[model samples]
Target: MFGGPYPWSLYCGQWSILPPAPKGNYLKDKVVVITGATSGVGLEASKQFADASPEQLIFAVRSVEAGEKLLGQIRKAHPNLQDKVMYLDLTDLQNIKDFSEAIKVFGRVDILINNAGINPNFDEGPYKSTKDGYERVFQTNVLSPFLTTLLLLPLLRKSSDPKVIFTGSDVHHIAPSDLIETALQNGQSIISAYNDEGKYHNPTRYYESKLLLQILSRNLIKTLPDITTINVNPGLAMTNLGRDFNLSLSPSGIVGILWFVANARSASKAARNLTSAAA
Candidate 1:
């Protein structure tokens, strides 16, 4: 072991490794469905899957403009993916039903990425929405995904390797508990319970939602006993999430820093991982 024999630090790169999925070997033929695929991490995931050349690439987006814009980009870049677009408004229960029905035509949904979510009414919180009668955030971030997954079970179960991934955050791990039953009150949202702006505005509910995501993932893994469920955190990345934050970055820039130093790997990478997990 001569010290001069090797200069390890000379070319050291960030050490990141994805557990090899022996199943990842078979993605070219798999049909994948990605929710919230128009922008942010969802868009990145799509970019990655474009190369894998899956049999079909279905993008579920809230806005046609966003979906169409992403479609043009992906097509221009890959030119080989059999991509299709569908309208998906997670806040609307009917929309979920519609999207689910539309997806059944595929007959097989090997991978389901519950990545689309919204963080809003920060001044109030999800517990205060009348649309679906659910917290705006809870509906989009949690229940919508919940219902969508339930609806797709028939199709996903058809795949040899069916998996569902709920993108979670560290915040979820740090929320006050009891949120479990609160979020699942007869389909409609219950904002009346938490009225203190301080209580709801704090990261509690957001984290609670994520915490529930993990719990759901675990419960589903056991309840379904036929599918693998995983929750992943993308770490801090400079995503356009601030567009939703509504906070002024000019002051402390903590959000800006989090958005900066954390590194936002392209949306394609997120898509790729979902593809990789499915593969």
Candidate 2:
């Protein structure tokens, strides 16, 4: 093996000897929901979750079409996993409510992964408001997951050792103020707010989202004693989540090679973390 990345030990071709899947049957018997499931990290996590016989895997995506497409492909690849896609445009309040309602039919949720995000559009990235008028990243990355988690809390409680996992990042260490200001819309720049740009710093949006998420998870952990909450960065995931996520931080090509080299863990690692969270 390679020496591995700077921050995380995870890397390509590395094997995790974490015992066989789990006592549960293929994760299909358990209820697992992953937001942003249409692509990127969410998709990878979903694919891994499919390996276990969980009772249900709910793929929450803003686009019904994309959700359906992902479902088709996942189904074709893993016929045993009967995952259903639902419309959850987190920026839209009603959409979030509807998503919660639709999942009500499932009755219980054993695992929940809050992992959707959006980089601000370059032209007016930072200063833009979502359809619900909240800051885009805050609404999509933070609020959406926050609200979705709330709606599913009851269902989570019904199960034993119900788990909630939030995807975190190292970027949160910088620009904590921008994250708070963006949440309040205190004249945050469109680019800086969306991409985490700064007169001295650049590409803060992804980091800021993670900061808020870390804080949110810490605080929420206090309130829910029964529900276990854990946040993981998963090293450098290869999803379209960061680095050029907004107008800034767009490092040129060879990202796969670099990411694979630098603490770059596959979506399977993140998904594996989720599996541990469930246990």
The number of the candidate with the highest lDDT is 2
| TM-score of every model versus the real structure | 0.78, 0.75
Lowest summed-lDDT stretch of 10 residues in model 1?
A: 1-10
Model 2 alpha-carbon drift over 4 Å, by segment: 1-28, 121-126, 178-202, 242-263
For model 2, residues 215-257, the per-residue Cα lDDT tens digits are 8899989999899888866545556654443333345335434
Which pairs clash in the backbone of model 1? 23-279, 24-279, 44-267, 44-268, 45-267, 45-271, 126-135, 127-191, 133-189, 134-189
lDDT of 1: 0.67
lDDT on C-alpha atoms for all candidate structures? 0.67, 0.68
Instruction: Residues 1-279, candidate 1: write the lDDT tens digits.
Output: 001122232112112444432333265777888888876777777767666778888888878888888889988977877888899988799989988888888889988888887654233333456376766666777778889999999998899888888776645545566543554664534444433333455334565667667777778878998888877765433456545454545545455455345444444443445555555
In TM-score terms, candidate 2 sits at: 0.75
Error of 1 at 240 (Å): 1.7
